[model samples]
Target: MEHQIDLTVEQDPSRSYRLLPEAPACGPRELTVTLRSSARDVVEIAMWSETGLLPQPRAASHHARLTIGADQIASLSARLISRWQRFVQFEPVSGSNRLREKKPYLHNANLTVRPQSELLAQVSELAREGAYLLGELLAGEERALVRFRGHLLNVLESEDLRIRFDSDLGVPWPMLAVGCERLLEGGRLTVDPFRLFLGHRHQVESTSGTYPDYWWVSDRHHAVGSANLDKDLKNVPLADDVLKLLNSRLKDLNVRHFSDKLLPDLAQPVLDEDVMYFFCHGSYEEHGGRTWHALRLSDELPIDAPLVDGYRKPHTDAAARRNSVALFHPLVVLNTCFAGAPATTGFTGLSAAFVRHGALGVLAPQIAMPQVFGAEFALRFLTCYLDEGLTAGHALLETVRWFATTYRNPLALTYGLVCGLDSRVVTSPQEGTTGS
Candidate 1:
């Protein structure tokens, strides 16, 4: 005999649950009803089991008090996710008992419901199951924090465990992944509402600046460049679509497109308090009485040639020797190689040069590879940092982790780049001045 179940909330008139053809009352079985509230209001959940059209309340006054932490509840809730492997403590609760006290269970038998994938899939299952069988779920008297595993995302205020239907770019999944990984690996499980609330504010607006605080010293032609493989390497060693995705992200970051022509006005005062991004062939040069970490515009022209003459050398030893500084130490994103590698003399290449000239931090790749993955990694990593409120290091780790998971390859080797520059580099430095 099929039974019907109905759930009513006393406090929330707006919210009611309907579960039809509920399971027949086969003795007393523990029912789990998942409730996620957008606000701190006490949510009352009622579950009733019926048989033969008779209204037999399997559990009456079956209530669970949900006291949402100030940080968890948001003005506008966004869905949160967690991975199965990260299963933590869940306090089992029922209408029969108030304060269902038990030692925290780090593992859940139901975690095997889905194979471990990204954090998004795991939480969605939990939330859906809760909503699917709302009728038979018994709410306990005391509020219980059912700790599960997942990441979180929201508009600009709060994170909720809800459905994610993406017609386009609404949620930043990579950012959320980074945040969750940081919490788990660092052994920090709590969320802070105030900081999260403020961080959400930046997402609502366009991140592009009216006048970019940074500049890219790149080829003049493909100034706003595209990734093109050389003829010798033409078998499409890797997917080109990945490169396209990377470029799309770069465009969002306001990275100007350019070809291999040098822009003459690089040495001019373009440094802002923001950052500088260099995406071109970069390495150290030990020739022409000029030994420095060089950033070569992909298509180099003669310095004295009339065709392109305005690009000034960014640094002159005389200026540093004289203790004279012209621009602010901008954060340098070096999408180039040997930038952070230490030389025999214990001197690094590009990072050393940037630091010497008063740049905050330099983000660069350690090894050389095909430009496709490199560009993708750089763009995604930067997007994570600037848009997702992640520190430089966290962003790098997350980007690599995503690659490792998605491609199931040793992305950590190719794109598992490091953020060589430290955050503290920019702190002591004053605004518009090189802190040396």
Candidate 2:
């Protein structure tokens, strides 16, 4: 019964999904959702697929199109952030304990009355609403997801979902929960909210910025480095454990710890390391009428967008035309708040800077997170990707699901990905090796 196809065949097949005349083709295993600015308070969503979104062999081959009020999505993103921050711990429990306190409290949130149930319902409603909007191409745009997922959208059973939001506003695609309160066509219900969250259910990534040069690393060992910018978190046992894992678990390991360097030191041609970790605080500043996101390590000055762009932007067009690009594009793990869900998808944040210049992918929390969870999340992700040999996308998706199921903590959903859905660690960094 669980695998039963919950088909909601379109009453009016005319409105069903269809492929566009010139819609480009992508891999059958992949789906791309693009959100672009349309007009005031409106955004256009386009879903492209090669094998069609439905499950049947003769499924509608048309691309999906929908226009949603930008404000609605913006509100949903804010609500998701507010929900987790209020119920779950965002900052470290204590400044001194930095990374010592480790516990998953998503189920009860340490609350005796168990308000999680209500919040779960709310999150699922948000998820349902999101699906309803995205599924606007279906015959019945107003139908619940449970009635359509089995035959319409190829989700839950698959995790390869790539999203590109070219608008100024960034949506938290992973945190949106779906169908927790809905009954399927067979009258079966999925009341478990943890499993319904998009981030936990799918390997979703939001990417923007110019494509990086397809440069390769000719080295044999994968270089792993981390920066502990905050003194409070610098000496934590978690950091030590991570460093040890990078050394022992990975073959031909190259582990390094970066110091609290200033802009000049960071500006040089010395951004080397395939896997970069940062244990620091994300800072935000308003400059030139735009929010310039920055990162602070220890007491050093903030590494903001402008500073990063000066050195991080991809090679000049002329250089790129000459086939000259960074020897290796790194996968950056920023355990900082607002790093993943940037204030703007434009070149206004450090994540954007790295993606624009060169990065396999950048993973970071969309909002402020508990220090304990941040440390643990980083460890789990790196362990899965570097040691377990999972792609960056799978590593992230599995980690979030693990946390939500094992610890009842859904904070992992707060972390978002920019590019690198298929990024994975390599044993030999051959110039031809391409997993990022």
Candidate 3:
């Protein structure tokens, strides 16, 4: 897919250009940004991907920067945003390649910049900016900054402008807001992330039996002894409330709830459902020199299916199996801590595993989040996804917006969409027809 944004100084007052893509780019895209200026005053251009995830710069490139001629033609590569990933920075290049000869400058200054110190400063600035934005958005409420770093894009610059993105994903808000704040604070021109997570309509196929449309699973009960007693002790009634909400709002949809007994069933594919909601404790464990994120079922058992037999094997020996069967394709909502944590090698976290195994998308937290916040966000997200018929990415973005507005907490950024950014649980009649 390709998108074009024409930015004229006169029409856009804030000089903030918003590029709302019609749909999410299924693959790489070419984004042409045309800046209309009467005089060639060096305009600093910054690009941000609102979906949060941005492609890393190539080895041959210094930073994610592109140079375009006065003709307003530039070839740039774009990637769709996945869950848990946030923020992207790109440098706009102009003129000849010889310009790379100049020393790197800090914030348009001629002074040579040290990489480490500059990164720290950028992180701090982003943190402060994020907190301030949340404060303003939430009416004087203060929030702590989620940690982030400033990645230097290796691009030769003929001008002193940059483009940064602030995504709705919880942790990177400060970084994105800081990038936006720079433009607003300095009165520089800016651009919104052009790549989007497009929405696709789904058809509910009828099966022979009354299969569930949504599955609510929780592990409120643990065995006699558990590794993390504190988590087990502090029981937040998330699944129950979420179940009530889903049942009440989505009366036409089949919703089912399960507890500890259903952990074994998870080993099998969830063929009959559209959504799987898991409210439990999750963590990363090292076995056979590989780290895996597992959700706790009982004190002695985790959702490491590769290690266990059909609920018959001893928990001690389950570690020997490395390749577990993947879950059936469902939009999985993992309301647990560290379920979305990135892996050191392959996709290791619970959310990543789900995606690897054919799950449409996984909504999980990058870090440990408060139970109350998690439940509330889940409620809002489901409402938007099922009732309002929004795509997973939009639903998450809406939920984060509400959280930021209501609590002024940057922690909302911690929750991420792992994949299936364009997925929706319910298909409206019109959307169904169009999709068909």
Candidate 4:
């Protein structure tokens, strides 16, 4: 049996609705409900199977219910068409992982509905059913329908969603997706899958400054008995390769391949650098009962102290004081394991400390990252951003796409971007003039 109910209550701000229909007391019972709303305004709807009819005592048994809001339907349709467009674009191209050069599909769309907790929960459930349903919804084949997955819905907060495309949809097979809850209503929203690009053009315009230079800091050596040597011994060559690549492309680039150096000395050049790349070992250590994420430096010095100090006024000589002030905010890339994990205390970790100082953003791994994949990702990311003039976020995303497609490895998703989502770093003319 099918039932329709109007859930709009004058007192409630969300314009929510609820539907209840009668069912038999015996055997198995199946009921379907269809919700209707005006097309003028986008409405978000959520539904769940209730144990009993209205005006009756509620039963303990509950089942997953189909909730379809007007806005969700429209949004799903739009996203499907956009994905299809991207798939079509990649069909003709070979050996290129770049997204088609075109305007984003969600550039002008307005999202009216706020994703409440319940709605987010439903979306989480939808993602678990595999990508077939979402693909179908995106294809615009279903107007409104419900399916019974025959399991109790596990109520868990959605952290991330993974969608895998069937073979029928060629290439770019699986996607690791995240949802943005707050968007400008009656404002433009661009559909850049994965939110990969940082739009830092405004930051550049506001400061009236040219793009910053590059600084690559690498530590290939560790103490004789250091625990990190076993895990990170292979990353030394990778770091060297990265340094060479940057030197070849960037004009005002500085490379510091250090061993047995203090934190302040190693971090001095980083104060004025525009882009800081660290290729070393990282770990989370519990010291004095407090956890900290530290990058292992060549001098066997943990970077935790410098990060704790952050950017502070120098109390020493005139030269030290003058150099203490930063000229440009850097975008730091910590190409090491566990660099992205948050510390137990205030602004902890190498990545967070850089951001706390004056960095525009930090790209680090949330867990122990494979050295091979890390090297590949770092090389491609820097190439795209420095050579191709792609934003840091976009470059990271493109590199991840290439890595994922090439190796069929989803480990790229482990790398996280913290802050500086819209920052861009371009090569300056002065640096351009003095090419290698």
TM-score of every candidate relative to the true structure: 0.33, 0.71, 0.46, 0.44
**Candidate 2 lDDT, tens digit per residue, 325-391?**
5433568888877777643532566776777766778888887666666777878888898777787
Residue pairs whose backbone atoms clash in candidate 2 = 18-62, 18-63, 19-61, 19-62, 19-63, 90-369, 127-177, 229-297, 229-298, 314-357
Write model 3 residue lDDT over 112-174, tens digit each, in one string.
Answer: 233433433433443444434333322311121110112222110111122212211112221
Report how far off residue 304 is in candidate 2 (Å): 1.7
After TM-score superposition, the amount by which residue 53's alpha carbon in candidate 4 deviates from its true location, in angstroms, is 37
Best by lDDT: 2
Model 1, 242-320: lDDT tens digits are 3444354333223333323224223544333334565555455565554434444434422211111123224434445
**Candidate 2, residue 88: lDDT:** 61
Off by over 4 Å in 3: 1-239, 249-264, 267-270, 287-290, 305-327, 343-347, 427-436
Question: Candidate 2: where are CA atoms >4 Å away?
Answer: 1-29, 52-67, 89-169, 183-190, 213-219, 235-237, 247-265, 287-290, 314-318, 344-347, 428-436
Candidate 4 has a TM-score of 0.44
Error of 2 at 266 (Å): 3.9
